[model samples]
Target: MRFLVITLIVHRPDPVTGITPSARDRLREVVDSAVLAEELGFDGFGVGERHERPFISSSPPVVLSHLAARTSRIRLFTAVTTLSLLDPVRAYEDYATLDNLSDGRLELIIGKGNGTAQRELFNVTPEDQWDRNAESYELFRQIWRQDTITAQPRYRPALHEAEVWPRPYQQPIRVWHGSATSRESVDLAARYGDPLFSANVTNPIEPYAELVHYYRQRWAEYGHDPALAAVGAGTAGFHVAPRSQDAVAAYAPVFAGQLAFQRSMGMEPVFPTLEDFIERSSALIGSPQQIIDKVHRYHEQFGHSVLHLHAEAGGLPPAEHRASLELFQSEVAPALRRTIPDPPWPWAPVLPEAAVTAAAD
Candidate 1:
């Protein structure tokens, strides 16, 4: 299985102790954690975008470009580029430039973002977001693949033939549809023969598993190879210690803070308690064995080759976060990798020039 590190860049006041990181510190920590993810053998590192209070990753492309310069091998991704809220031409030009800089190692996951904050910020209606997402993606895809294209849409003017330049390193960088409780995203992925990444963070597995099944069924119906239908799954949280109790004790405060923040925002708490949260939700907080078991169970439901884990959220202390990541890489990752083969990503395997030179050194 391919392991990916996903970040929300959330910083919430401590529900129990009332402590939170400064905005500057939170941004620095995100970059530090992304660098560490590479050192720890994660295949990909992605940052989520949010245009609201408590979230600092509103500009993922800038952050990812910085990460690209700092790290050599790991693939970089935007967890979900809010395509609906963006101008398609600009988004294509910027990310295609990033793809060239990253040497064919960029994956774009597009979505209609959750929450009303972004919609209000961009003056988009929730009902119209899907239409915007579809139109923007169609144009973006053409911009990547075709040298010249003529297109007209509600938001864009007619183009006789416009060529978007600094074309991507890859002929067309892969796109994964980010689905959060939407059949529209699933159908879009199926229609385009792109992959689907389910947001299983805030909910249980049944709902998402059904979506994956729907995607596969539709993919086959669309005359694509069912085996080529790639699906990626997301988890809520992760904290693996030497013992289960220690893991819970270490992560509970942060989890509690997150739950409280969610409730304060008038969003329903997905779990009743921390214990219940880890058990039912995709929060993988436990010992190595327990984590391994839970991931395997999710694999059965998701049947996905890539499993993304959110180990750092709500601004957990940096040191504690590093320790949790270390334990996962040292103890949990090897066992999981041994049990499952890596996912098929055509752009995943090229070695960076630095690695080649280092071997000579």
Candidate 2:
């Protein structure tokens, strides 16, 4: 199974000390975490995009470009690129350039992002978000696959035999539709035979599992090979200690702070307490064996080949966070990797000859 370390780049005070780092320090930490992820054998590192308060990830391409310069092998991902709010032409150009700069080690997970603040900033109505996402993706896909394209899209300016320059390093880098609560995203992914990444953070496993099952059903309905329908899942949180009880104790304050923050935003959490969150949600807080067992249990429902855990601690100290990651790398990951098989994917970039022939005449 492929493992990814992802962060939303939230800028919140430390739960214990109530101290927040400077913007520069926070960004530096993100870069350092990506380097560490590569050193620790993670397959991918993802940076999220959000244009709201408490989030410093509004510019994913710039952040990922920095990561590309620092790391050689680990794949860089946009946890969810908020494509609905972006112009496909500009988005294509930026990511295409990033693809080249990263030597084709770029993958995208696109979504119609949540929250009213960002939607308002982008002037996107809730009614039109899904349609915008679909149209944007179709145009972006065309831009990647063809040299010249003519598109009369509803949400963006028309394209007239346009050639978006800086051809991608990967002939069509893989895209995974980020699915949260909606079937529209799932249907879109299935229609294009693209992969799906479940935002398995907010709610219980049943809803997310149902969404995955729905995605598989639609994949077959769309006549794509079942073998090729890949899926990935994200955990709410992660921390591992020498003993299960120690992990629970260590993460309690972090979870409490997170819950309080969520409630302050007028959002009611399903998992109200740390124990409830660990037991019910996808949060992986326990000993190595406990984490392994929980992953296996979720895998039974998700059939997911990729799993992403938070790279940065929400409120835990840096030392404890690093220790948890080290324990995961040394103890939990090896066992899971042995038990789970990777989903079928074309990892290598398409041949130049193939891309040339595939391009528009």
Candidate 3:
């Protein structure tokens, strides 16, 4: 299976330490984590976009552009670019430039953003956010695929033979639709024949597993090849210890913080205890073997070949964070890769699709 390290760039007091890193330092940590993810041989490193408090990842293109310069091989990802709140033209310009800067190693996971603060900030209502997301992406996809675009979109001004510059490095960049308990995103992804990325973090396995099933069903219903449908799943939390008991114990405080934060949002806790969380909730907390088994189990249900782990250290000590990730690469990743192979990508593995087509001609 392919692996990615992704962060929402949650900027808050350390749950364990009660100390918050300065904004500058927090941003620097994101850079360092991307560098480390590349060094550890992870397939991709993603930074999320959240226009709200307690998150500093509002500008994924800028952060990913810096990562492009810092690393050479790992693909850069936008966990979810929040198309609902963005101007697609501006987004296309930024990401197209980023694709060039990154030498065409870019993939996107686009979604209608959540949170009341973001919705109000962008003046997008719940009733229309999904419509906005679908419309924006339809325009964004055309901008990437065509040199000159002339179209009328509801959410944005009409374009007549418009030529957006920095023409993409990729012929048409690969996009993954990110959805959490939303059939709208799933339907859109299936309709466009794009991959689906399940936000498997917030809930139990049943919901995400069912959504993957629905995505596949919809893919077939849309007359797309079932074999071509791809899925990626996210982890709720992650830690690997030499022993199961130690792993649970080591990760207890992190879970406590998570529980408290969930409550502070005035939401009910799904998994009330750490043990239940590990047993359910898609969090990989246990010995290496246990984690490997859990991932394989999820694979059976999700049929997901790509998986993401939290890149942020969160409440864990710096050393513990580094060690746990190192251990995962050393022990857990190899096993999963052998058992679950990745689906083939539509574009050329190395060269951009444009380059490949040019060579063929």
For each candidate in turn, the TM-score is 0.92, 0.96, 0.96
- Residues 65-111, candidate 1: write the lDDT tens digits: 98898899999989999999998999988998888778767898999
Runs in model 1 deviating more than 4 A are 14-17, 311-316, 347-361
lDDT scores in order: 0.84, 0.92, 0.91
Mark the regions of model 2 whose C-alpha exceeds 4 Å error after superposition.
Answer: 346-361
Candidate 1 residue 254 Cα shift, in angstroms, is 1.8
- Per lDDT, the best of the predicted structures is 2
TM-score of model number 3:
0.96
Query: Candidate 1 or 3, higher TM-score?
Result: 3
Q: Could you give candidate 3's per-residue lDDT for residues 34-149 as a string of tens digits?
A: 99999989999999999999899899999999999999989999999999999999999999999999988999999998999989999999899999999999999999999899
Shift of residue 7 alpha carbon in model 2, Å: 0.7
Candidate 3 shows a clash count of 1
Clashing pairs in 1: none
Clashes (backbone N, CA, C under 3 Å), per candidate, total 0, 0, 1
